[model samples]
Target: MSDTMTVKEAARLWNLTERRVVGLCREGKITGAKKQGRSWQIPATAKKPLDQRIKSGAYKKQAERLPLPIGISDYRLASSQYYYIDKTMMIKDFIDERPQVSLFTRPRRFGKTLNMDMLRTFFERSEEDTSIYFKDKKIWSCGERYREYQGKYPVIFITFKDIKFDSWEMSFEAIRNIFAKEAIRHSELRNSDKCDEIDKKAYERLLSGQANEIELSNALLDLSRMLHKHYDIAPIIIIDEYDIPIQQGYMKHYYDKIILFMRNLFSGGLKDNRHVSYGFLTGILRVAKESIFSGLNNLTIHSVLDNKYSSYFGFTCDEVKEMAEYYGVANKYDELCAWYDGYRFGKTEIFNPWSVINYFHNECEPRAFWQSTGSNDIISEIIAQADNEIYDRLTSLVNGKSFTTYIDTGVIYPQIKSNPSTIYSFLLVAGYLKVLKTTPSFNGDYMCEVALPNKEIAFVYHKEILQQLNQIISPSIAVAIQEAIFSGNHAKLKDLIQGLLMQSVSYYDSVGENFYHGFMLGLCALLSGFFVSSNRESGNGRYDIQLKPKNKKLPGILIELKAEKHGTEESLKKLSQKALQQIIDGCYDVEMFAEGVEMIYRYGVAFSGKKVEVMADSVSSKETIRLSKSDYRSF
Candidate 1:
């Protein structure tokens, strides 16, 4: 529509001085600005940059906000002790047209455990009467059709969320301990009048935490029977984070052993087990049917693709709006959306609930909450081990582009080594990627288009890529480069680094010094025999990277990186030589000189796509020689 605003108009609209508005336009924070005779014609739709300054106020007592429940899994405790956005109505959905076995798979910390705990509270036939906890909750208002079922069933709930162990034996111990704890929960089973004699012995063994591995395998199924016998009704079973052992197995190289045990445990409890009235299991990925589910039947799976329980796993827009209003940060809702929104659970657009809570907890200041929670080693490993095809796909993803692949939500971990598509599927399920759209396939899986969901996740991926580059670049290459640098072979070192950058191009675009910073650091890191540090304070400035020989006999290498955005051949040469000059002027080698490192090799390398320039020289405090640059590119 050719809608435009003048600089003065922009200033008024954005609530800033005209000079400030013009500065923002020049800085490109205000997009679509064009200069027109000492005035900036800005896009009418352009918005002001968010002010990040922390507001200071007079000391005054304020009404305390109920704390954001960070990591508490018990819904009862979280709801009572902290500010909780209610998800209790999930109980109503479960009770209404219940599935025989419903498996809800979502990424970690999307309220799976808390929801399972809520289910346990609602249905567990406990002496403590949990109905009081739900008295004011959403489900209680629906009358007896829902209310009648409250506290009416024997619930067998167990979470394997933290079942990680180093050894199969230790993993079994974890399983055994879980069984023993559940036995204590239902200790009534130990003295059940209807329980058989041998069952009593096994129950005691399980309670004593001394059960054999075979007994532990049979524990959950047998517990259901005992609960049924004790309560005279079938038990509702909830197994939360069901893939922990399998995931741990995949990572720790004990897949077959854990798979065999898990296959038996899940099958025995849920597969045609007459003692279980129904079952609910939650996991991040639905481990493929042939491997884990085996011959089990009557299981209904709800992934992010399924609409029935979409809002159950993440916060809906309405829910977030309600929260923002209640928290008095309703005005900052757009900021929240920019960081945490765009996760899709079925038809519902979802916000990451964990990040939302953390934002409020930190007084409405937004940060990357979810990215810092885990190691995310899986994502790093996948990229580090990626084939050329996988690397190309990842590069596109990092560039804010979407691509389509056949998504089998049932990811078999072993297949990831051969099938690049499975890596995408794993990433999608693991909360690293988001599905943009999906089309039905003949095989019943979806042909899904996916991209990085938000800025926070993308930032983490950027960091991981830098880390992966550092890990993947060879130690031999680093050694070779070290020799080249110290031996006055600047040309050889430059070629080695350039080759590494070109290799990384298949996975990540060498966009700027940001990427190149990691490239240089990665190479130096492989030479662990030396003291290698990045961006440390020295002399007048922070250097790109510094290499000090641990042997103290070798000269230090000071590397400075410059990204070539635009330049002629002459300008490119000038940039590389200028970088070398910047290192000397900034005294980047001050630390090395003080430590009595008598010699130094300062190299300034500049990159422009595949074309690169290197200007390097060996310098000491007294004499600086432009190390025989016959083989190097000249400025």
Candidate 2:
């Protein structure tokens, strides 16, 4: 009640460690009053509690009306009020239940770093200017018990994301610079008697290129302990993106060496440091604890597959609904959900927050906005390694499929080999594909059949595949095939088909006599802006080639080819009969079919030892037409 309050009184009022309260006074992160000789006091104003000061209507308006910030650097502003649901109440409880090392793994952009940042803000005491950030925020709404724990501890927060570089020296230097900047910022650490000994000796070792793994780890531990000793507080350690080194190392094939370095570094600082209050670590992958954490036996792990904290790291369904409403796109909620909201972890269903935010910013007209994030490098790798079976699966996905797979974190690597099934599986997990069915596979595994979830991914898939094929197949070959089909150059087409056969793998040998037949089918598949299907069901049998051009009125061609098994004349006659039968069976209307046609021109080509013969017939009037090689070539 008096101007002077003992450390015990401050601890009881704030629900903080007496060590923490005293540390705050020493570090100048808080202020109140000093007793005549030995104890500390609090100003009457400080006794009202921080949360009470934040409850005014004015603060609520300020929090709501603030402009949305732009770019990644401004995520704090945009994310401030978005109340990530309390799925991690257990994680918070875990932090409070006992002090030990904890590791959590989730995929990229899953909010691991954000959760760590929130923890740091909650425990580390802030000056007036910084404390204003939390006024009327969702964390404050948790009530007085949480508020009482605010601004009560010293936190040493480190994120490994910036440590990425092509070389080991660059990575080490980046980490050193980060620690140096943080050390300069902490007043107690900078001004303490041990400051000269720690900074000069440690930094000299780093800059001189003489610090080994053990020395570097020891330096950091010494810095942490010195800060705690000078401030009378054990520090809470938050390590974000702990698996970054492993990821980069794997891609660069420096895994064993980097693992050795990280193992020693982490173990030294986190394993037995008595000055550590607690630790929280997050990464995309979970290396075996024996390999990474070593003797840190107190470590606990939370993974994406675990039901415990799923809602903590991703945007929930209700959050998406609220976002839609907030952005005036409420009507499009169902469409958005169909594309991005099907991922389930435990009881929590989540949508990719990055994609949702992208849609809000672009005001996209109901499409796959997330595909623009980056090229599917892993998918390309899979495709490059795919065999015939894998190729069949890719075709199945494009045509439509009912199978999906969950991708564990570390399973995808930079140089991972591409296969059709693997690429499709990656796409499914990365939000490019969505569930089409919950069918049971033959092996008894429940399969979520998936297809391209939105137009964005479909477009990318089409573009990239076509681009790769274009590079592989000669442009002259592609042009020749197009000219052959459009001009009805059966001889040149037959010759080209033979050439393709010569270049193709041995699998096509059995169907060699039908080379032109298969070539036409392959051409249809290669053409862009046309819906191409082979052996599609007609009235009674199947249509050999069905080409629905992108532009209406541009003639959807249906063709049937024959070999010279019977005589060339008889084959032509048979071809004409078959073409007419196809027109009738396909239900082609002779009148009112299209502008330039009563019935589509049906072509029946017969081949005999490089001497190609063509016969064209009109089904509307029962007309048969034949042309010689010179005339056909001129046409």
Candidate 3:
């Protein structure tokens, strides 16, 4: 074998791309690889490195050193074989709270399924002594008062997290299969003499996959009754991601059917069912507005806005810090916090467990790990139907701003279209935004100041939420307008914006400065490397818009906008100059100057009907030019 080989040779020999080979060399994954000018030299004798792409179930085995459970939701496996955080204390909380039917509403991948399964493990009666999974954990330390419940009750566990389908028929079939699987798990009741003939027949129908809609609706109730009769104890019901199918139905135009089915399922299983010991459900939102739990008055909801069980769903600050120390990346705690630690569940600050574990698994590099964990269809739908006001607020959120809004934590799917204000509620429960401050509102609602949760969500919200502005203003127009603004081309900017207004705005919409402000704000939000702000205190007074470059080398920008009910192009031209003078007179460049911006661009834009005018000037700390009030006296 040759002592040395070029990256190209190694790539061909190892069946990898040359760029990948170069990366491996640079990362020091390729043994004996050395840099030679811009290229890499590798040892020919060195074996090809293992591919970093993980196949599904690739990490199922327990290694000599336990790996972080990246996707493991099974409580038994995750708690026993992985570096599990002891969440058995959640059991203690549930017992203490003792709600008859507790529903936990949290965002996807925030450990909802795992926590529910943990409940199943701690409470379900199993022949194999499942108490072993809880004895060494926090619940065991709480004394016999709490520990007495471990493995004591029959449990009916099912997850609808993956029950996504395009039509009602397929969705129902998927649901039936789920219940059949669960029924088979409890097949002992099929032959038990304690079970009545009718109950056993209903169980057999479920197990045989022959249950009709009405029969399936009654399945949970019948099974719970049979379990009670067979074991002489009522069963605990655990439903995880109970709203995933409903969300899918709303997205796919089968909302009514799914809601009917879910309503009936819960009604039979949970509402006044003496056969059920206790019921627990977890999902992103409480769709009680859908009437799914209409008469189930005993249901207790702990949403993202509630203080109960707050720390159980996601990693707390201390948990994350402890995890970092255990993984020997204690120094990366601040980075981890910045990227993943801004989620506020109730009053508790929470870090995304999925992203945190993946961060450590990926050797502590930070990225938007949680963004791709689930579908962003809700975000897409919200952005698609957003009004100008919604667009303005969304723009502010992406620009590191927060605003007070009413949050209906029990946000329904239909409200996404009918009630635009509910967007904040969806974003909050779906884990896109974090509450900065929250106050209780009427009837379980919340008035909260919310913003993009963390750097990860900031990146995600910008990419997922703000990018939807393209649907309103096309990408080409956005790019052209941005180019004109940055290049100091007043004529081009005016022409582009005027064309957009004429093409997109209604005659009614073109009459207000607020409309134009939101339009321009939405466009500016798409800009990269700029800290965009609107109606913010700058210089001496509020500036309509300010673009402070994240990199000081780029020029800073301040824009003041004006609108008139009716005016000629000549009058609009004069109004634009008046607006430009407002920037100078108000000293709007002071904040940028304080931030060490060497160059500034000030733009004045005016709109009347579809006609537009723009005036722009450059300011530099290196020089000063004074403008007289006579510049706008002609107006």
Candidate 4:
């Protein structure tokens, strides 16, 4: 640690590879003096600790009172400092058991990136500034083994989520820029012969706004190798969102070319490079290791089904409780857990951190908070391509399902044919669904069946579908239906129904009577605090529509609609008889119902071709039946 210490000594003292020390020097984050023989002398003053630099007053204040780490960006280090979940023990067990390139797949927004970041911060060499992060953290409490492991190894981290391109050239350039940015941050390369060349060339190319993906990847690898040479140690590589490019490439049909280029480019630096220590990668889908890391034999796969390290990537139930208490929302913990905490990654029962943080920040009233993250354009694409079977499953999900199976990621919206299974699978991985059962077979394989994890997710799935459907159908359809129902406008309602039948024939075919039932239900579903029941099984039979207004004083409307392809009168009579029977079967006394509650109005509506007829009746007190016509219209 002396001013005249060699790069090797600095590496030893800092628990870093010679390459990383060199990288620090190249980025100007460290200082070194060169002798006549061309070797650099590392100065103790040049190495500012990570903890000391990053733990400024502003950061400390922010850390002390942060609500929850939602949409957190700097997961590599910051997450550990403020709200680190104890997944290290699990990770350690996994690493101890295997030595291969590991892939941990989960749904999007399930904290995959955060886990990768934690790994990087845990294993990577740190400057003095980083000590502030580990102080008083749980890891330090794990005793000497944990303390001894701090500030160890050189870490190379990358996230492919930001990589976007219309062509291979654009993707290459984007990657190159990322490398250049990282290199400029390390001090060891500032005075290196290779650093000077790469820096000069990179800046010029950047200034010119020119550089392709291949060239950029090459330059980054070359720079990485130079750092490795200088440090005389291998680099630990951690990649996050690794499937992004492939997903995009698959969509754009640039898969073949981009895969070839990316394969060679990443393999050159990560697989072929002699200075690599270990690697970990994460994504929503598990692309075959052979396709990406061809020669890396020591790869370990930790999928969602893997028991080891399942808790490593998500918020556990205890962690959720701690977060609620920390944020002064402990009272709402039960409600919060009911909505968001059913997901089980392994033995750990977890909640969706993104939604949880959003709930706290917004004062804990549950809503579709997760949707604020993105437009879910991929889902839109899937729905547009989905087949009849997929349509049926979606209906089942909306109605409620006890179990569903995970669909293969590849089959999710296959390019050639629309696969319903793919849509279901995507929802499963996207945190919209969770595994409910794992049944083992005699062949050593397991079947993991999933379902909507909680009520919030169930509502979200339905709402998103409605939103998407709104785009495809008339935007005014929902509004028109709502107005018609609230105002009891039989004419407008009939017209809307006829229009829907004309336009949505295929959808009706896909869902049967449930289509009409759900459509009517949707009108009330969007309104908060309203109770709606469709086909509610009773002693005698099911009730078609039972709408209970939020306020008890407001009259609940009971109505039934029937397809009167024969004629309106017959259909109306049948509807009236059914509605009256519902009241008798449920023992609903009209007179003794809540005071100030409006009298129940029973309606029997029937549809025949382009015409709809409405028949209204009121049950008399002395067992007399009184029938009347409110209004009738044809479209």
Model 1 steric clash pairs: none
Which regions of candidate 4 are displaced past 4 Å? Answer: 1-66, 76-91, 94-100, 165-169, 193-213, 217-223, 403-406, 409-420, 440-446, 466-635
Candidate 1, residues 270-361, lDDT tens digits: the string is 88999998899999988856457777778889998888889988788888888877766665565566568889988899998898888777
Which digits, one per residue and each the tens of the lDDT, describe model 4 over residues 536-596? Answer: 3333333556665667655456666554343465564555455444455453434223323
Off by over 4 Å in 3: 1-64, 472-635
Q: Between the candidate structures 2 and 3, which one is better when assessed by lDDT?
A: 3
Tell me the number of clashing residue pairs for each predicted model: 0, 7, 0, 43
Candidate ordering by TM-score (highest first):
1, 3, 4, 2
**Residue lDDT tens for model 3, 239-333:** 99999999999999999999999999999999999999999999988999899998999999998888889999889989988887776666566
Model 4 TM-score on a 0 to 1 scale: 0.65
Better of 1 and 4 by lDDT: 1
- In model 1, where do residues sit more than 4 Å from their true spots? 1-62, 469-503, 506-566, 569-635
List per-prediction Cα lDDT, in the order shown: 0.77, 0.56, 0.82, 0.59
lDDT of 2 by residue, 1-635 (tens): 46566777876576544655675666565655454477666564555223211111111222353332223422234346443333324434654565578787765565666678767766786663334445555655666766666677778877887566666666766666666566555656544675567565665564444666667766557656766776677778888887776666655567676777788778777888887878889875566532678778878777544556667776887887786666555545644564456565545677766666655554433334454544344445555666765554444444334445533322444325532444544454444555555544566333555655433344345434422343334567766866666555655755665565466444332232234454455555556655554443344444556565656545456666655443455564555455545545554422224323323445555544333445443333233443232222211
Report the Cα lDDT for residue 493, model 1. 72
TM-score of each: 0.73, 0.56, 0.68, 0.65
